[model samples]
Target: MSFSSIAAAARPRYGLSCALAALCLSYSLHANANTPPKIGGAPVTSVTAAHYYSFQPWASDTDGDKLTFSVSNKPLWASFDSSTGRLSGTPIPPANVGTFTNIVISVSDGTYRASLSAFSVTVRSLVNSPPLISGTPATTAAVSQPYSFQPAATDPNGLRIVFGISNKPAWLSFDSTTGRLYGTPGATNAGAYPNILISAYDGYFKATLPSFAISVTVTQASNGT
Candidate 1:
């Protein structure tokens, strides 16, 4: 073949090879563009109520696209930041103190999105301790005579204490803050009073002491003879 004719034949082959290479490249790019982002393993977390809580999820897109995050079925007291892929907020009392399940989080690369479901999170609350009776009170009193007694108690959390009595006699009175039981019995009060129940309470929890027996004796009037 002549040199010009050989060059002309080679031109078509070279152009065809370039076109085939471009077609393959275009297909590879399109496939990569359609690939979805991947989310890393979801973790179980425990948080405390009235305290700050935060967690970050890992994710990536094969096409090097920027990924945004979001969460669904999250606790009402908490929030998620899509820009940072962080779930964070301060949990409230009562409502937020419990085990929560099936939280879903999604990551998106504009066109495609991926999700993780059934995540577990727990919020623990501070427990209030009940008060305890330290010792028994005096169980006897004289009619028409002066009487004084105080019930002792302690609280595990060092909370302020209040005292109360149930089924108390008409002559008896109680001091809630000092826990003092003081009353002067009248002549009609001489009897077996078996219905008195003493209780102590902190702000949040309460404790009651067992019932006790109290015997009142009749007092004789003294006169100069």
Candidate 2:
């Protein structure tokens, strides 16, 4: 074979190799431009159900690509909204009192992925540690009688109080923050009350236990023949 012919044949092989190398380089560069998968998840800063809370993730691609999400380890009594980035649910209480639960949420943005978010959610039960109720005496006449009650709750989280009462009358008044109970007895409130439950809410959407009920007996005045 002539020297020139040998060189010509080698040129095609060299060019093919160069093209393959370029393709490989392009792929490597494309992959490197993208950000590495990161594990990131923020706990619901506020109440998830009553209010709206979200789970956020930080990821990026070199080409400024869009992001998608996937949850690997979802928590109980909780849900995530990827489009709106909302993670919400009604808190469920554990069997034990004042118990806390840890939620795991997995976040992925299509190309990038992360797992086992450390700070996802802290579920708490609103029971046992409810507020207290006072003012109503053990015995009171039902006829022409009015009684009032307020939320008397104590929680470690310093939760805000919301007032609610049963067997309420127009003259009855209640305060959530303060455990003040004031009300005049109506004529109908002469019977015995089995229990008066008051509910106090906490930061974790937990209701106070016992509902702060009070037993009462009514004695009517001597008007019988």
Best candidate per lDDT, number?
1
RMSD of candidate 1 to the truth, in angstroms, is 13.2
TM-score of each: 0.45, 0.40
For model 2, the superposed segments whose C-alpha errors exceed 4 Å read: 1-37, 41-57, 83-90, 95-109, 112-127, 133-160, 167-225
Q: By TM-score, who's the top model here?
A: 1
RMSD in angstroms between candidate 2 and the native structure over all alpha carbons = 10.1
- lDDT by residue (184-206, candidate 2, tens digit) is 55445434454555555554444
lDDT, candidate 1, at 113:
89
**Model 1 pairs in collision:** none
Alpha-carbon lDDT of model 1: 0.80
Off by over 4 Å in 1: 1-32, 128-225
**What lDDT tens digits, residue by residue, belong to model 1 across residues 117-207?**
6687899985766888755767888887777777789977566688988877778888888777779887778888886778898756778
